[model samples]
Each structure stands twice: as structure tokens, then as C-alpha cells.
Target: TGTICTRTALLDSRATGMFMDLAFARENGLDVQLLTHPIFYNVDGTLNEMGSVCKEVEVILWIDDHSKQVVFSMIRLGKTKLIIGHTWLHHHNLEINWTTGKLTLTQCLSDC
Candidate 1:
């Protein structure tokens, strides 16, 4: 949709899929796509109080010198705006240095 914006994102190993805050997506004027199937729970099987997740957006995520188009499901996130979850980490073969707070992508799929 050519919408470009930057925001703090959480890299959560516990999360199963990428996510974007609903309000943030609206504020950035990102084009929202309706999900073919709505989501009703978190990956952990906990109930989501915000109801079903029916919207999503595709955006180019830039981290330092790397960039990739990612789809983030729209949901109500309390304080966090964006989340790069385990699916992305595993697909990219990401390595994280907990001591130094550094992230490295060791591999890329054929798409890259």
C-alpha cells in the first residue's frame, strides 16, 4: 500500500505470528486487509478479550540494513505497537545475542 512508518517492535519468541496494534495501523493509514479466517485466541490458547482478529496489513519492515515485507494481524495491543514473532525468527534463522541485545539473520528463505 506504500505506507511507510517506523515504530518500536517486540521480538517475542513466545508469539506465534507477527502482530500490529489496531490503533497504530489506523494512525499510519496502512491499508487493512480482511483476514480470510478470524482469530479468536492467542498462540498460548488464552482467550483474547478484543474479540476476533479480522484485519491485517502488509508492510516493509526495516531493521538496520535489512528489510522484508511482512504481514501483521491487526489486534488490540495494550502498550506494544508491533511484534516480530517466532515464525519470522525461525523462517529467517535469526540469532539473538541476549547479552548484547543484538539480532542477526543467519539465513534467508528462497524469497529473499
Candidate 2:
């Protein structure tokens, strides 16, 4: 639809136009990315290392401890909640219990 459509009956001075909608997008999916300071952490969640990660169409959950980088990539991508850090993105899929501060690991299951 270039300027406007021809079927709408309008007044002589009125105007009409068309715009792109979400339904027309090719990649009909949400971009869930995380940008953060890459840090490494041990099993006890202690400081190990630090760094930055640059990614495209990917998720990362980085915990730095002892100067080491820990990156946890996600298999499934969502269309909402794009987490961003200072300069990079750290993608981490988490299912937090609203009732409690317990952190739960998210698993990516195959649809087939």
C-alpha cells in the first residue's frame, strides 16, 4: 500500500495511509538477547574473570570468576526481554519463581 488505498470512501480533504504491521514481518519471532560484562564464576558463584561478548541472534549468560569467562548459550530464542549490558549482551534463560528468589535453569526442548 503505497500512500493509501482506493476502496475507503473519504471526503475530498481527508487523507489515508498504510503502514507495516507485525504480522507482515518475515522473521515472526522475538529477539531475546543479553548484553553484559562477561564474567566467570565457579560452582560457588565466586568471581573468576571478566570480559565482553558481541553476538547476533544469540543468548548468553556470562559469569566471570577468577579471570575466566563462562558463557551459557540458549537453544531457544524468545521475542521479548532483550537483556543488555554496558557494551555487550549476556544471554541467560532463567525461570525465576516470583514467590521466591530461587533461580531455576531453563531447558530447551525439541518440538518434534
True-vs-predicted CA distance for residue 90, candidate 1, Å: 0.9
Error of 2 at 76 (Å): 34
Top TM-score prediction, candidate number: 1
Worst 10-residue lDDT window for candidate 2 reads: 10-19
Task: Tell how far residue 80 is off in model 2, in angstroms.
Answer: 26
What would the per-residue lDDT of candidate 1 be over residues 6-62, giving only the tens digit for each residue?
Answer: 677899888888989999998889898998899888767888887789999988888
What overall lDDT goes with each candidate model? 0.85, 0.27
Candidate 2 local lDDT, 1-112, one digit each (tens) = 1121112111111111111112212143424244364324433566533222222232223222111122222221234222223122113333446585444444322220
